[model samples]
Target: MNRKTLVLPAVIGLLAPVLAACGGTDGGSDGGGAIAVGTTDRFIATADAPAPLDPAYAYDVGSWNILRQTVQTLMIQPRGEGEPVPEAAESCTFTDTGNERYVCKLREGLKFADGNPVTAKDVKYSIDRALAIKADSGVSALLSTIDTVEAQGEREVVFHLKTADATFPYKLSTPVAGIVNPADYDKGKLRDGFEVSGSGPYKLEAKVENDEMVSAVFTKNADYKGALTVNNDKAEIRSFKDADAMDAALQNGDIDVMSRTLTPEQIKKLSIDPGENVELIDMPGLEIRYLAFNTDAPGVKDKAVRQAMAQVVNRSELVSKVYGSQAEPLYSLVPATITGHSNSFFNEYGDPSTDKAESLLAKADVTTPVKLTLHYTTDHYGAATKQEFEVLQKQLNASGLFDVTIKGTPWDSFVPAQRKGSYEVWGMGWFPDFPDADNYLAPFLDDDNFLKSPYANSVIRNTLIPASRREPDRGSAATSLTEIQDIVAEDVPVLPLWQGKQYVAARDDITGTAYVLNSSSTLQLWELGRGVSG
Candidate 1:
């Protein structure tokens, strides 16, 4: 879910598909290809979303991958497992206990890549423009709580929120809140093309071929005054279309690291034998995949129909058959790693019992062999997506209660079609915009959700979500969050499939590979370096 509408950000999360971009430096000794990353993510830019690199419109992980290095937000989610730390701002805190009015003091002499002074006005302008240009979707919804922003002199900016929200700081850590230069970007519309200008650890120059971003060289921004360390002088992020070529590039020493989407075959082989000079790095994952149905669709519109399908499908079988134990079966939209996670779906539909599925349909007066078309993207989620859908079709059809067919659409078309509720049922993968459980549930369940499905429960959206956001200690909101999961499990608008563990294949000489992908799914390129171990 991305630009033009709000669907992309919630569906796709903030990232496009893979690892971020940087410039070329060199080998283990420091000479070209220093941090060349090979990823299978193909960035699709439509007329509605022309600027994939602009912070005002870059919501997908692919664009966020570049934005994290090229731009700095008010706060930064540190490389590993710490809370978001200040980057552009020296220090920021809520001025009042209500969590509505917040204040941030800019660090002394912070400047954009162009060497222009970054003042309170720029911060105000960046936030204000993002709000004003809400004509299209970015991750602007994340910043929706911001009622107004006022710049007090050069070093200070004040934020007034619509309601109390403790998750505001975490939202600031995302690419949506990234600080931008006033001179380089348009205030009313999204900046066109892949070029980016921001004040972060790096200055990026991207290469685009036929509307797709191919390479972006990230040279260290000497004028950047942020908390992150710049390990490499230059870094290059190369996007590949083929997983085989990506693996070949990593093995052949043409690329230092490979991430985003790795094939199951590659993961299995790499785990067994990582070959000479290669290391397989697996991190705690914040990514999840699920099946969402359009609530108004003919075949699955009835809640009973949706519930029956959810009961028949077996998440354990799919994860094992596809990921080969690289993923865990998810019982809720919120992954287990997140706070307030629960096995609400499992508690309701424990086993893959055809009897349970048949009974549910019979009680609802839905005829036998309910026809359903499961839609998935061909190019976006990698090779396993097709097989995953095929397995899903087989599982449902074999149950004798449903007739399911799978359709694979290209990403560019799939996204547009999803916005129009073209698919009765479709598969989507979400990477959290922040670590909070609200991020996982709100985007799909809210009344103003990104999903075309009209799935809305006032208690969960207006009541439960606001309640969770009000609590300063996120852990204390467990009861409310757990209740949301239970409601979602009962409604069955979206079916939880499986949660994934992130994998990054890096050369032995690449330092900071472990810290590249943080819990928030933002790739921290500043952590990557050659010829050093961390």
Candidate 2:
């Protein structure tokens, strides 16, 4: 869809006043012989609490989820679609022939939860702060296309780009573009602590951090002016040591909802006998799990070794046996739902065959019995990760072509270690920042990538990606995407494993279970509420 034509110039002028005066409705019943609806605390999960709650420093999924609820962006992705619509802004347009200059007009009378007025300057300052900090895992890379951000008067903000990018609007819809109050934050430094000041649907009431476990309580923001209506007055998000503890809490009625990091077996059991207390809600598969090979490492440096591992690894078995129907085999770095995705790995290697793998190794003059180490995180992805790695170890060693050793670590250390090239081969998962093919290709294939592996292909990095981004019609970028995937399959820097199906298990009384999960796989906390039947 072409988002450039989504909003018209005249409609923006007409809607500015109406949107500013539109405040949230009174949430679920307050009590006094009525259902204790708004007063109920809705509990959810995060693998861990995001270290610094500053929008500029928060990049992980856990942090982004929290920020998405507490912060407001210029544009937002509505339920069931990837196209961004006006959120805080009344309207946004390109305003230039080259698609390099983007202009957004803020709605009238916008105010933070603290009752401070939100102006164009706060929006510009928030983005400028993110670029200034440039944290290792920060959102600076996503905003690298912007050359300048200027606030023209109170309501209008303009962005000048270094190059033409059709997908620039999608980037602004992410948490990276969350507008913060400039008076509460310094432009040069990241704001410390978990307390936040935002104008989204909810405001942070309190944050309590106890060792590795952390919890945050949110209440409906009276000053929030946006499309979303807060259904519940208060919500709680807690991080557990593992999925087991989180699931147990859900079963005992201590927590109202549970999502992410549930094992396949746990999901199956919950689905079979969910009881009258809870219900399991299944979401579309928009996430991918993969194995990344450190190309600079010793045994993994050879192309033949990487290719052999790709050939012999049984994805079908991995999905069927380990993940059950919760996931499906993925043959490309890009998931099937996205445009330009192809089964390049499957077409090149076919079904798992030991003979083909051995032949490929022999053709490259590599000696038999190649020894390799594979690393994975125990507490990061889920409880199933350990079993998944064991299954992989068994599959590779059974072929007699290689000897694999398995190592496990916690998420706290795994991320930094992997980025430092500490593992020869490792497991990783990706949840898209935005629902675009570029999100899949650019982050992993670029010269300076998130993986921090020594992989540089000038053609794919310099030519194909740039050409693809310049296309106004995303579908027309298919050819470049196909070429990029083909190059990835041949090189095998990272092997595609499977695409996951999102599951959110919540009490049956929750009214908006299905509506909470958006197309980008983010939870819209405002959509959740305890029904009157409860």
Candidate 3:
């Protein structure tokens, strides 16, 4: 499925650069100086890319979380643990009239950035376009039940679902259902990347093609009726290639914040770096890094073959050598941050014992010289991905059980190839939507999952997922997901290698850095500003 890549307005040429310096402010106090925020602006924030700026198209939590505050959803997910609750809509009622008909009443005063009051019509148009385009992964399947969305009135949108989906409201909380400005889109496309606008708190200050893109915060819109989180007056995003450069900029007083994973090696250096105010905030990350098998491909289709490969992965060695203990060994695809996460695979295979792996492979009749190509992304994640794969290849080959060939691709090509079942085995990572166990299980277990792993166990797929989804309460759903985890543990289609620990080194002058563990990918732009006392 080659979806059309949306060509957003080219990122505008670099605007006059602002001076980067630091100052202190108390809660709700304006910085009076620039607050520089940094990230690796690897991908242009656009709809055509794997991750886009629009809530409707952005899949990964990295960009979507930023979009969440900027663009309001029909329902807002609570920033902390637990099930998603309503935000933009006062209440949504589902009528068991078969086709999963859901009627929602919007909270008063909701409006887009353009000052047009948000109405039922806008929601319908946003959802309809998603179903029509279906190329952007973020919005397509999430709106699974929406057969038709018709405006019942100005404040109410009625959704006629295609099936009896009881968990429809949960889907509404996701950013994919974000309402868009009708005037900005052209036949399911965005022409003005620079002018790209949303109903969110901040607006794009200017767009640059692949260069630095910036945005500024405004007082809550008079038409806007949702909750606002940040206390900062404005935010400036400067994209960098790696954490070192980001740290360097922070040291030079070129940026106010550096919020992303810096390797453990970098952490050690930043701690001692002169003039670098390094802060270590350890919150549960919403992301999971794993080795996915192309189940459709030969050699990987066998469970023992997959398990043998899984057992050979020396996670400790990978972490020690490549990540330097910054990451924890993983057992299942589920990250420890989520409620129902379990070390299911670790409970079974904790050590990288080649003898045990060989026995299992022998029992399954897998002979020596088992060979396959391992693919990894060169530009994504961090510098350690390739080293991680290199270490993996050495461990497996040293065992004399398998021979390995490694291939590399950039994140853009790597994503499509992995999704389209193009690789035999590949390295991949995930950042969950709302810190739920179902996000780890349901998205990966589906026979047609994005990773293209068709590991469909009826127990986990049909029953466990659907059951978890129906529970309005996440606690109950987590129990169901635990059962799903056990099933996944039994059939290891994907090997959980390690859980990443995010490392951010900020200048000592920056303060009010609070980690809300709910959305691991969010920077919580409001809670941060210049140091109140330093």
Query: How do the predictions measure up, each by TM-score?
Result: 0.92, 0.89, 0.84
Q: Model 3, range 400-450, lDDT digits (tens) per residue?
A: 888998988976677766766788888878876555676677667764465
Best by lDDT: 1
Predicted candidate 2 versus true structure: per-residue lDDT over 1-534, tens digit per residue: 100101112223234344332222323332222111111111222333243567776666666767888999998876555467788999999988888999999999889989999999999999888888776663567888889999999999999998888888888888878999887877887766576788898887544544332666677788888766677777767667677787888767677778766778878887777645777777675789899998988898999999999999999898887898888999998899887788889888899999999999999998979998889987767888888899999999999999999999977677778877789999988888888889888888885566877888999977998888888789999999989999999999999999987777776555666556565667677777766433
The Cα local distance difference test for each model comes to 0.81, 0.77, 0.65
Which is the better candidate, 2 or 3, if ranked by TM-score?
Answer: 2
Task: Output the better candidate (1/3) by lDDT.
Answer: 1
Q: In model 1, what lDDT does residue 504 have?
A: 84
lDDT of 1 by residue, 1-534 (tens): 010100111222233222122222222334444578888877656785677677876666777888888888988775445456777888999989899998999999899988999999999998888778863443677888899999999999999999998989888888778888888878998888888888999888777788887887888899999766677888888888878889999889899888878888888888777777788887677789999989888898899999998899998899889987778999999999777999999999998899999999899999989988899988777889999999899999999998888899887788778877788899999888888898998878764466656777889978999999999888999999999999999999999999987888887777766567877666777777788432
Tell me the deviation in Å of residue 483 in model 3.
Answer: 3.5
Task: Show pairs that collide, candidate 3.
Answer: 9-193, 11-207, 11-208, 11-209, 12-207, 12-208, 70-200, 230-526, 231-526, 277-508
How big is the positional error of residue 349 in model 1, measured in Å on the Cα after superposition? 1.4
Candidate 1 has a TM-score of 0.92
lDDT of 1: 0.81
* Model 3 residue 290 CA deviation in Å: 0.6
Per-residue lDDT, model 2, residue 219, is 79
Give the least accurate 10-residue stretch of model 3, judged by summed lDDT.
12-21
